[model samples]
Target: MKKWLLTTSAVVMMGSAIPIAWAGDGLWRHVPSTHAHSSARAVAGGPFAGHADVQHDWQLRSSVRVSRQVLREAYLASRAVYTEKLQKYAKVTPSQAKKAIAQAHPGMKVEDVQLRNIRTDLVYTGLAQDDEERYLVIVDAGNGKLLLDRLLPTHHERVFSGD
Candidate 1:
């Protein structure tokens, strides 16, 4: 009985230790890390500042490869264009576009609104309702004109069927 009890305890301890060792190894193994010792070797801007292939081997190992400042500058530039176009056109507010989309869809609700520049025209794209019931409502960015308002799947169906 004494020998059997000792062997059972040893087996249980081994099983628990196996899982604990695995958990500990996984905790640190998958975590993203960078080994950059200093900023002296950082990439300088020309045209390929954030290209994945241009990044160092150490940087490629980590999730992020591009400079945050570069991304911020691009975002600010796009926002400036969005603001300038909205103010200059004075055609439709996002709220107005939402209302128009809601009216057309009856029970559906507008989930998101985005301003897109297609050629010289500013278009408002509103995603309405859920994923399955979603509709893509495109309106003139400057005049509140409904250019294209169709169910998302219907649009895909037409394209796939070569309609």
Candidate 2:
């Protein structure tokens, strides 16, 4: 009986240890750390400054190795806050923002102009005509800056395909 009890206790201990080891090694391993400086690169916020149609240019090498217009009129949706002194900095009406974008591009259409409370800095996803079909432009709200414009990758279609 003594030997049996000792064996049973040993088995119980081993069983508990197994679960602990599994938890430490397999299940709960590799959690997302919130440390500031873990040397991890910051995740890119959706291809835009996330504010307005801020314009920026970047050079891209063509398949033939020649430089070409890779991006243009990238739009981002952002929240714009106008402090007490800068009333112009205050809130730009949606119509006002639309006019600004049109004046910049001259006959460019703004698509998906969603005004949310959080990203209210005048950043938005806009549609524009370029070399490709429809460019999802990242526009800056405050200054109507075109941050980036490019052909969206085909990978997005897969996500919408319902696999």
Candidate 3:
């Protein structure tokens, strides 16, 4: 969810592929790329670049940390639920859930498909939209059971910057 670290050229190249940064259930929405700009200072080397091993060191240590963080964020509601172990257990993939959600919601556009934690089970959630209307559809990842199908507020488009 903390996508703010995305570099400028990377963000611009990504464009629409930018995921809708989520906050909490209804507290998330799409952040228009209009505000994503590159400052010269940001693009250029900083004063410490020549003096420190900052970039190289982080590049070396970040892989494991990044993977762990992403998995950790997946089950924010159930912090103890270590989601790195999810692949071995989840019967349903996000793509499968997306197809099912689209089939169920007809004209709804699937904005994002993410893993969420409800009670103790891993749940797959689909953030969807139809015109100006929004919807949230969830299914149990373990048994493929429908858990939640609800309409969200229409104007709930406040951009989340992972804060």
Candidate 4:
């Protein structure tokens, strides 16, 4: 055990000594750390500095940020198109849609009305809720006819079919 320990210590000493022979510094190599030194951060935020270094100054603008902006703009454009379709094709007003929901479900109160396209059909979808249950009622956008009145599940896995 003592021979093994001596041999291991000798190997470690030789391994450490090689770096000291190659480069004069035995303590640290030329590898940069993952994060900058705390002194650099202190100097950056210190009062003595003329220009304040914001967090964004050091943060990289990644493709994820670009994609998020692109997604937001695309959503806005799609919403504008939906709004145009609602104005052009929807003969029924929001009040009429709410009234349709009220007629079918006596106790349910219509909370919000939205224009949505289910595949190819444009409908006025309304979220209705009573004391215990919630429902989603759909009214035909073209002729003001009641299309679907279904109870929305409280918790369920949604399977979306996308193009």
For candidate 2, which ten residues in a row score worst on lDDT? 70-79
Q: lDDT tens string, model 1, 51-158? A: 322233222254645576855555555555556656556578878877788887888778767776678677788877764587788878677878898776756676
Q: Who wins the TM-score comparison?
A: 4
Candidate 4, 10-29: lDDT as tens digits: 55457557657544432233
Give all TM-scores, in the order shown: 0.46, 0.29, 0.44, 0.47
Segments of candidate 3 deviating more than 4 angstroms: 1-83, 156-163
lDDT of model number 3: 0.57
Please list the C-alpha lDDT of all candidates, in the order they appear.
0.62, 0.45, 0.57, 0.64
Per-residue CA lDDT of candidate 2, range 1-163, in tens?
A: 6465455455545745765864543333444435543323223442232223222222334474322231111111011211222334435545655555455556656665433333455454455554434556555555656555655646567588787
- Evaluate model 1: give its TM-score: 0.46
Clashing pairs in 3: none
Candidate 1: segments with Cα more than 4 A from true spot: 1-77, 154-163
lDDT top scorer = 4
